[model samples]
Target: MSWAEVGQRWKLRLVQVDWYLCLGLLFLLLVVISLSMGAWKLNLIVNDADALPIEAVAIRGERARTSDEEIQVALQDLMKRSFFSADVNQVQDALEALPWVYQASVRREWPAKLKVYLVEQQVVAHWNGDAWLNIHGQIFDAPKRSDIGALPLLAGPEGQSKVVLTTYRQVSELLKINGFKLDSLSLSPRHAWHGSLDNGIMLELGREDKMARIQRFINVYPTLVKQSKPVAKVDLRYDTGLAVGWENAQKESQ
Candidate 1:
C-alpha cells in the first residue's frame, strides 16, 4: 500500500480500539452499580423484615445485687434497634455500667431477641468507710447499702486495698481461732497496722511482724482477760510484752 493510505488505516484502527476500551469500562461500571444496588435492596429487605425489633431480652446469670428492673433500664435504648443492626458493644457497655455488674456479654439469638449475661460484684469488705472492695480487692463505689454494714471495715491509702485485705484475712483467721472477732482493720500513712475487735478492744500491730504480734495477742488473751478490769486496748508494737489500757481507768478519770 502507499504510505499515505497505510497511515489513514492505522488511524482508523486506533480509533476503533479507543471506542472498544470506553465500552468495556462502561460495562464494568454498570456491573458494579448493579451489584451495589442489589446489596442495598437486600439490606433494605432485611431491615423491613426485622421491623419487629428486639421483642425479648434474655438475661442469663446469677444476679443477687443487680435487679431485673436495673437490667431492663440499661437495655431500654438498645432494644429499639433491629437485631441485625443492634450494636453489641454498646449493649455490653450499658449492662456493665450497672452498679453491681462486674462484667457483661451480649449476643443475638438468631431472631428478634438479645441475650445478656452479667457477672455481679462479690463484695468482701467496706473500703474507706465509703466504697466497697470485691473479693479481688478492687475498689468500686456503690450506693449506701444497709445490708453491707456487717462486712468488715478495711481502710488504707489508695492502691493498697489488696494488701490490707490480705492482712485482714490472715489476722482475722488467727484471731477467730482464739474466739476474737476482728471488726475493722486500718493501715496508717506510716505503714502501721491496727485493728479493732468486736469486743471493743483496740490492737496496735505496728509496722513489722504483724502475724507474730497477733499471735502474741492470742497467746496472752487469756491472761489479760483474767485481770480485774476489762482490757480496752492492747499495744503489741514492742519487741517483748505488750501494754494494756483499761477501759475503767478512762471512765474513772472522766
Candidate 2:
C-alpha cells in the first residue's frame, strides 16, 4: 500500500529469484562436470553408482551382443543431460531393438536418473526355422541351445507366426482340461484354425466365435471320452453341433 511496503515486497522477490538462480547453476555444474566423468572416474570418487544418489544402473547385463548402430544410439541418448527435452523415446526405441528384450519402458526417476524396465523375452515356442516367438507376439532368432527351452514348436508364414503362437496357447489349455494332449496348431491365411491331437486325429476349427466354440467343445469332450467314442477328429465348425469321426473299436469298448 505504501512505498516502503512495496520496496520490501520487491526485495523479497529478488531474493527468491537469486535463490532459484543459484540452484539452477548448481545443477548445470553437476551435469557438466559430474556426468562428464567416466565410469572409472566415478568409481574413484563415489563408493558406488548407487551411493551417488542420482544415477544408478538398475539392471546390469552385457547389452545383448547387438550391432554397434543400436548400442551407439542408446548410449548417445543416455549421455545427454538437457533434462526437460531429452528424447526419451529415442533411447527406449534403441533398447527395444535388442533381440533379448520383449518390451522396454523408460521412466525419469527424477532429480538425476532414468529407470529402465525391460520385460526380457521369454521364448514360448520354438519355431521350425531356428527362431522363437516372445510372449508379446514378437519373433526373434533363438538363443544358443543352452538358452533355448523345451517349449512347444510352432511353424507358419512369417506374418502369421504370432497369431498361431497365441491361439495355440489358448486351445492347448482347452485340451489339457479335458485330459487330451496337443500335437500342434496351424493358422491359415483365411483366419481358419486347425489342430492335431496326440491321439493321431486332425481337428479343424473354422474361423468363427472362438470362445463360444471352444466352450462347446470343452463341454462335450467328457461325453465323447465316456462313450469310449473312437473319435478320430472332432470338428466344431458346423453350426448344428460337433462332428466326430470314429477312431477305432478298441476305444469304443473302453
lDDT of 2 by residue, 112-144 (tens): 566666666676777655877777677787355
Residue-pair clashes per prediction, in order, are 0, 1
Q: Write the per-residue lDDT of candidate 1 for residues 1-254, one digit (tens) a residue.
A: 89999999999999999999999999999999999999998787666535647788889999878898988898787777777878899999998889888999988897788888889999999999989999999999878766654899999998899999999999999989888899999999999999999999999999999999999999998999899999999999999999999999968878
Listed per candidate, the RMSD to the true structure in angstroms reads 2.4, 13.0
- lDDT: worst 10-residue window of model 2: 48-57
- Considering summed lDDT, which 10 consecutive residues are worst modelled in model 1? 44-53
TM-scores of all predicted structures: 0.89, 0.48
Query: Runs in model 2 with CA error above 4 Å?
Result: 1-119, 143-147, 176-183, 198-201, 227-230, 248-254
The models' CA-based lDDT, in order, is: 0.90, 0.69
